[model samples]
Target: MAETVQAATLRADVAIIGAGPAGLFAAFECGMLRLGTVLIDALDETGGQCAALYPEKPIYDIPAHPAIEAGALVAALEQQIAPFAVPRLLGRRIERLQGSRGAFSLGTDHGDSIHARAVIIAAGAGAFGPNRPPLPGLAAYEQTGSVQYYVRRKEAFHGKRLVIAGGGDSAIDWALELREIALHITLIHRRAKFRAAPERLAQLEAASGPGGPIELVVPYQLHALHGDGGTLASVEVATLEGDRRRIEADHLLAFFGLSTDLGPVSQWGLQSALHHIQVAPSTCETSLPGVFAIGDVATYPGKLKLILQGFSEGAMAAHAIHPIVHPHTALHFEYSTSKGAPGSRDAPGSLAGAGHAPRPAAA
Candidate 1:
């Protein structure tokens, strides 16, 4: 399902795949370099997993701000790229990748062709889905929204009893996030030790008490879901000794992480291992010329799976790609502070100084 754009075949200096944090930043980087970029994603909207999964999740590592919600970060990125007016082909996946450096062709799932000088694959865990727990009558509950994998809306869980099961960040984060909205919150994990940020774990522990906002049920695994029709009544958990306990709840959030598949990306003739594309660390370019991989889907020696690192990689890839896009010209590197972004107050011939609005850059 591709959005109706100005033309059936879109052309650009760079065609970015994924539309996640890295992809969005790549668009901004390309725009700063005065290159036309188009963002394409399989999801209907931008922001990728951050928008789809946990929009309310807080990220502490992003530079500048001490803490920011995932959704807010996406919004800031969108606003940063507003002046460029980068074309977005949403609800579509790039299925085919062909051609070489400086001249590449891409075909999407919805019968759309995109021609670009360079391609950047910033896909984070390409084509991801949640890993659901195996429980009887789970489908019925899921159909009724009694059991959910992703928290798209926080208001839906307001005043409800929630039984969160998992030991990862998603489980703990949501437990802390929904503690205020939920009438009662119980987090059940098979292990007492949880894998999450220390500060977040401390926050969860601080709020947890015998009969406070949240309850911690450790060393207990989900045994079964007891419900009537599609309305969840309670969740049954058991220990290694087979001792079981039932926690009354209206909804169950199982966050076992994601089961990711590279899907069409692996079939794009790029070198890949364990569903991760192999790329050169310096340029982030894949084995296939003109195509680069970044973010979680890209793999290299000493690669850190961090959002900030992906941002750096996007900058590196853009600089590397400058030569390919403008073969005759040389790129004289300049800091963003020295060269203000187009349409900014500091930029030459800015709309602010001209007393008129700036038009959107062509994509």
Candidate 2:
């Protein structure tokens, strides 16, 4: 594999970016080996995407557990690492990564840097989000610097007339949160009907209640953004009735989509997509030697992007390094299942003969 060193720091045994299950499991493996490790994430706390995106949603495929909510599962994984003091660098974005497989430097959006001996980038696809309106010139605006993703701080958009695009969760959600800070918000969506849950939509409608001066433009599509001196001034939009209108605004916020680009690591000479990282089968190593990939971001010959599979990968990757880390450890972890006669220590507890059980939900 080729090498591209766009890092901003240097020196570490292992640096795993992302506190998702995969990265957490990687830290677990490193803990088993007593190796120094660090986990970096953009969120203010642990649990990554699950904590932010869908904490209430039930996750069905975690091994042995029939169903678990994102937050609950994250809490459990955190408990698993309670005894292992893995360093966590939270609330920052990866600015750049550079150097060879064993050693790399990492830069962040929060004006800090770290070095690592190896890195496992499990940044799930599309973190910074997209510049919305889904039109041509917005792309140019995004490239030339007239649009924004997540709000940086309270003062960034203060006193600025803003046009927020989309009716999705983030669109309305962020709008509601930032309304106090924004001068004005123009909520625009292509469809009259929204995809947000009924409760959220209703809450938004009530929050921007009657007599409230919230601007909503439905069945409209923004055609272009006309600005001067690289500063956003106004936008031209086409309505459902074939009427074109222009609106003045100081900033544009698009929460309709997400765009992700594989950083310099992709050029590592491995054949993979711009949104995904590929690793070798069986060992979880990338095309580059000593460099490994894991979690939802990893794709190999035969791999599934589930937490359970990631757990297996983390364990396997640790096993792969056992020779270097713990030469005397056995090839596999010990497991014992109870399946035997009654009164035997190996017998699994069963209610079949001891008591009657209520009917459960359909299996």
Candidate number achieving the greatest lDDT relative to the actual structure: 1
TM-score per prediction, in order, is: 0.90, 0.54
Q: Write the per-residue lDDT of candidate 2 for residues 201-291, one digit (tens) a residue.
A: 8767876766553577778877778886557889777887888877798877777666655455454565565457777778776766556
Per-model tally of clashing residue pairs: 0, 11
lDDT of each: 0.85, 0.64
Candidate 1: tens digits of C-alpha lDDT, residues 1-363: 123353257778888998999999988787777677788888888998999998977888999989998999999998887776677888888888888898898888887788888999998998788898888888999999999999988989999999999999889989998988999999999999999999988898888865679999989999999989999999999999999999999999999999887778888889988778999999999999999888988999999999999999998888888788877768788788777765587653233432212122344
Please identify model 2 stretches exceeding 4 Å from their true place: 1-12, 95-115, 134-255, 264-271, 324-363
Score candidate 2 by lDDT. 0.64
TM-score: which candidate is best? 1
Off by over 4 Å in 1: 1-7, 344-363
| lDDT minimum window of 10 residues, candidate 1 | 351-360
